[model samples]
Target chain A: METQKTHILRRLFFSTLYLSAFTFGGGYVIVTLLKNRFVDQYHWIDEDEMLDLVAIAQSAPGAIAVNGAIVVGYKLAGLTGVAVSVLGAVIPPMAILTVVSYCYDAFSTNPYIAAMLGGMRAGVGAVITSVVYDMGKNVVRAGDPVNVVIMILSFCISYFLNVNVVFIIIAVAVFGALRSVAAQKAGERS
Target chain B: MICLRLFLSFMQIGCFCFGGGYAAMPLIEEQVVTANHWLTMNAFSDLVTIAEMTPGPIAINAATFVGTQVAGPAGAVAATCGYIFPSCLFVTLLAYVYTRFRNLSLIQQTLASLRPAVVALIAKAGIGILIAAFFVNGTFSLAAGNVSFRMILYFAAALVLLRKAKLNPILVMVLCGAAEVIFYCAGTLIR
Candidate 1:
């Protein structure tokens, strides 16, 4: 029985390590990758649970990759599992970045390197575009004038107006919470 | 003192930045722009351009550039350390709580709502980049007024080649830079 427990712990820790090494696209990409690995590859979490996990992970903060790792870890091995997984994922990226920073000044001006980076900028633009395209459906809300207005207004404010994003997030959260409460109150009245 | 402050400010950014890197922008702007006043808005804008033009991530670039400015190399180290700490801490804490209520409905709903917002943030950043890259000094200026119909065609052709083929980004960058060099050399030869 103890051996079985140890084996499970090993599998969980190794899987987390595997993800950290391979994962890309950052943030939401983690949700998709982990869902496949956890639910399909490892058989640790079921499909329904995976969906819930994605939602919860998205709602929480920090890098999505780290959040997803924590959620997946906890599902697999309780608190200890969570600790191992999160650390497993976070350590590798941080370490790699640290090493790169040390060398950046030396390479920052190489024209060949600059050319590659110029290419990366365009590629990143495409990747970011794909992300926005996926999310456009959620904000537009099927031709609902109100949502359309909110988005356009938000864009204009964000773009032309130069309004800050933090204020917008707070406003949206407050309005949403209040609306939900009011809707619940109205239901009680009826 | 400046180096210490640079490190601590980014550390605070690392700690409090909850959503994603985009979410960190406000804190970054506040610290780099408002509190420390190390970078003017124009310089901040340029730093962002340089950041986007480089690799890794925007937050990382900001930390390095701002760090270098404040206290040279040591400042860069401090800022980088400060920037990544919150994520390391938050993810660690989250690992503990992710299991018991994994099936919570409210959590799922909130995530669904948040995903769209994440998309919005990305879009906002993209628009900002487009503005910054194409719009120079608060106006549109591309390759000096030499952007003829042919130049537009070249860009369109490049876009097509990219979308229709599995071309590598590094290769595409090389091809585009080569094209620019060729164009410049041709113009010089003409003169």
Candidate 2:
């Protein structure tokens, strides 16, 4: 049992390390990648469960990538899993940035590097838009009118009005809680 | 003392960084550029570009880079630890609660409701990056001179590859970068 536990931890570490190293876009991209790996590939987690994990990650205060890693790790193992996963997630960027910081001049002024980054940013943008479409379709397919409306209003408030996301999350969560309570009470009455 | 200051400042940034890495930019700018004067605005912008270019959370990348600039390797460790500490604490507690009560209808419903909001958040972040990628100055402008057709082509091609062909995202990113480099070389040759 102990050996199996250690083996899982090791796998968790390497998976996060690989994902963190290669994921360039940011939180949502990493989250999508994580879902693909854990849910689609590893079969360690189910589709609905992954959505819940992502929602928790987004509502929390920190990088969604790290938060997703922590939660997924915890689900897989425990606190030790969290430590190993977080360490793996952090190392690559820290190491690369340290090197980049030492020789800032070379990296900043290289036109070729800039051009590549420019292209990568465009690619990252497309990847994120893909993620949005996938997740939005799932929400719409759930057949929840309230959820559909919330999704649209949340996007408008965030993209157009530029409202802080934290507020939107809190507002929707409270609305969900209140609605849940009302539903429960009605069910009890019936 | 410098390391301590870096750690504390980044700890504050970590505590307040909601949504994701991009949302943390203003808070980081406030701490690193305005309040501390550790880096000039131009350097800060450069740092952001580097952060976006690299593969990691922008907050973690920024903290490590700024910490190294202020002190050294130790400073990088300190700043990074500070930035990640809150996540460890908050996520563990939240995870425990979530796993314990997830079967409860209240929790389940709440999570269900959060799904669409989370989608919205991701959409907003994606559109922001998309605008930055396609526009000359990172804002929407229909003026022909302000749009980059090259980037739009790259974006459309990437979308097709990802959605239709179902290529690995990392592979798609590499292909786009390589294509851009070839375009750059060809343009120079034509000149």
Cα RMSD for candidates in order = 5.3, 5.6
| lDDT tens per residue, model 2, B102-190 | 64456666667766776777676566667777887767899878999999999999999999999977777778878888898889899
Cα lDDT for residue B61, model 1?
Answer: 63
lDDT of 2 at B175: 81
For candidate 1, write residues B50-135 as lDDT tens digits. 44333334565678777776677687777776765665455445434555434444434333334344445557765543333233
Q: Give lDDT tens digits, candidate 1, residues A41-103.
A: 878789987876665555554456666776777666666777677656654554554455455
Give the chain B TM-score for each candidate: 0.63, 0.64
Residues A79-175 of candidate 2: C-alpha lDDT, one tens digit per residue: 9999999998999999999999988767557878767777777887777778778878988898989999998998898778877655777788889
Q: Enumerate residue pairs that collide in model 2.
A: none
Report DockQ per prediction, comma-separated. 0.23, 0.48
Candidate 2 residue-wise lDDT at B79: 91
Q: Candidate 1 DockQ category?
A: acceptable
lDDT, each prediction: 0.57, 0.82
lDDT of 1 at A106: 63
